[model samples]
Target: MNEIDPFKLFLELQLALPRNAPGSARATREAFSLLPALPPRPEIADLGCGQGAEAFELLRLANGRITAVDLFEPFLEKLAERAEREGVPETRLRVLRGDMNDLPFHDGEFDLIWSEGAIYLLGFEEGLRLWRRFLKPGGFAVLSELTWLTDAPSPEAAVFWEDAYPGMGSVASNGEAAARAGYRLIGRIVLPTEEWWQDYYMPMRAKLAGMRRTYGELPVFDEMEREICLFERHADEYGYVFYALRRD
Candidate 1:
């Protein structure tokens, strides 16, 4: 049996997010519904786009142009391929390999910026502050992030994210940080229960099974299986927070 790579385990978890599921597509659409009144055509950028799922949707709605950005090279390759296959024009779709901490675009370059479940990769507050300059005046930024409904998180969940995302914060705290960073909160949504976990976990358990068969004794698989169980146990304490913000 081959050894299970921890990085592979993490990738499996990320790929399983609800944003990638059919039911959760509505959430992504709902998040975009908060855009400012503008012309039918607008420029949009999807920050930390894993494989362009949300970016594709934005392109359809904006009827203008979309730029997808990510740090991972392979994911960007897949995104580009998907775009081409979808009949999106080479001119209309642009993919960039860049860091979200310091976006490569000039100030006020995009009319709308979309980030789905990716802010935790960078500290939430820092990402809000750092990426604000990239938005056009009155431009809106939409993001989905993990947050706690209660002030306190379970010990297990807290410990999990502490290592996975050291800079995460609660929804209230994240909202305050957005305000401090000069973004007006236009809207916010707390995800419902089934919308969050079932979309991701069902696919993930299958993947884990496949991995276990391929890599029999790998300890990483055991670790990931345990984490999934814990996430199930604490499903009600936290959720994905979708926020719409405009430059103040």
Candidate 2:
């Protein structure tokens, strides 16, 4: 069996679905709601800005310049295309491909860091510590992470993410970790319910049906079909926790 490409799995899922990127509705609302009012012209970084969903949202909120960073070349390409289509200047939207775990930037480089459904790519606690250094004093980090509601997850869930996301933890534990990491808690919210799953899985299932017709049994089609099933099975129980953290 060819090893599954988890990143690709996420990419297809999101590209095929939603106005925002994947994950909980409540989480996106929470993160956006918690944003500190930008300066007259604040500089912001959208870490892991896959396909520029959150970046576009921030552009609306900040009305300021944005640097959208992602590791995937394809997503960055799409982001560039989006910039042109949306009439956002190439200069106004800067796209960079970089490692999230080892961010390449000087300390205090940005006023705000917008991360949605990405911190779990690295260990959540580890991201809390390392990414903090990138923020200026009193700078903000608005992020959403996969959070467990139950301290002990269902056996199926535990098994699912253990293979998928080993770093997953409950919202309370993550909040405690952020506090310990020296970030003042500005705000937090549990992701919204219906908008979360419908946004991704519903459209993805549609895409899979389309691909199945076009390709007539290709490997990619099969992979997406399986992913669609998984989402249908578990989306209700899984959710994200959104947090707005500030440097103390």
Candidate 3:
């Protein structure tokens, strides 16, 4: 048998049918409703959008253009296919391959900036500061980030997240960072545990199982399994918090 690239296998499995993150259409709606009613045809940017689980919902709720950007070509391809299947016009939902760290967009160009479970590619505070320039003065940015839900996390959960996200902050800390990043800390909505299991993990379990069958004991499999196991044990200790902010 030929050597299978574990990294490639990992990436392939990440396209787990529903979405690439722990988010749902309902959560997207809940987060968007927090923002003031957007102008007609509001220009939005969904940066680091993975197959656009949130973006698709946004399209259904708002009649606007969303520029969905992601680094992975496969993810972009999948998103385009989904958009096409859903009869979305190319102009309405523009897809592109790009880096989040250095995006090609004008300052004050967007009415809203959205990212879910992806901004961690850049540190939370760093991403808020960097991406704030892209939104109009009154524009809003909503992001779902992994955060410490409790001040006192169990040692097991604390050790895991500390290694995974050393800069993870509590809601209070992240809200403060949003203020420091030149935005008003508008609101927050912690994702329900159902979103984690139903939307994200349940979909991924089959993929991990497939990978395990194909390539036994790969590091990626172990890493992913560890995360799932950890979440099952300590879901209450930490979670993805949606932070809604508006540029000052």
CA lDDT of each prediction against the hidden true structure: 0.78, 0.75, 0.89
Give the lDDT of residue 43 in candidate 2: 80
- Shift of residue 221 alpha carbon in model 3, Å: 0.9
Candidate 1 residues 1-248, lDDT tens each?
Answer: 56556886666655644344222667777877876675577778888888777788777677878888988776787788888788888678899999888787889988888898888778677788888888888888888888777767889888887787667777888889899989999998876766755566677777778877756647777776776687678867777789899988
- The worst-scoring run of ten residues by lDDT in candidate 3 lies at 10-19
What TM-score does model 2 achieve against the real structure?
Answer: 0.84
On lDDT, the candidate that comes out on top is 3
Candidate rank order under TM-score: 3, 1, 2
Residue range with the least summed lDDT across 10 consecutive positions in model 2? 19-28
Q: In model 3, how large is the Cα lDDT of residue 55?
A: 85
lDDT of 1 at 183: 94
Model 3 scores what on Cα lDDT?
A: 0.89
* Model 3 lDDT per residue over 76-169, tens place: 9899998989899977899989999999999989999999999888999899999988998899999999999999999998898888889999
Off by over 4 Å in 1: 1-5, 8-23
Q: Please, what is the TM-score per model?
A: 0.89, 0.84, 0.96
Clashes of each: 0, 4, 0
Ranking by lDDT: 3, 1, 2
Residue 215 of model 2, lDDT score: 41
Q: Is candidate 2 or candidate 3 better by TM-score?
A: 3
Error of 1 at 198 (Å): 5.0
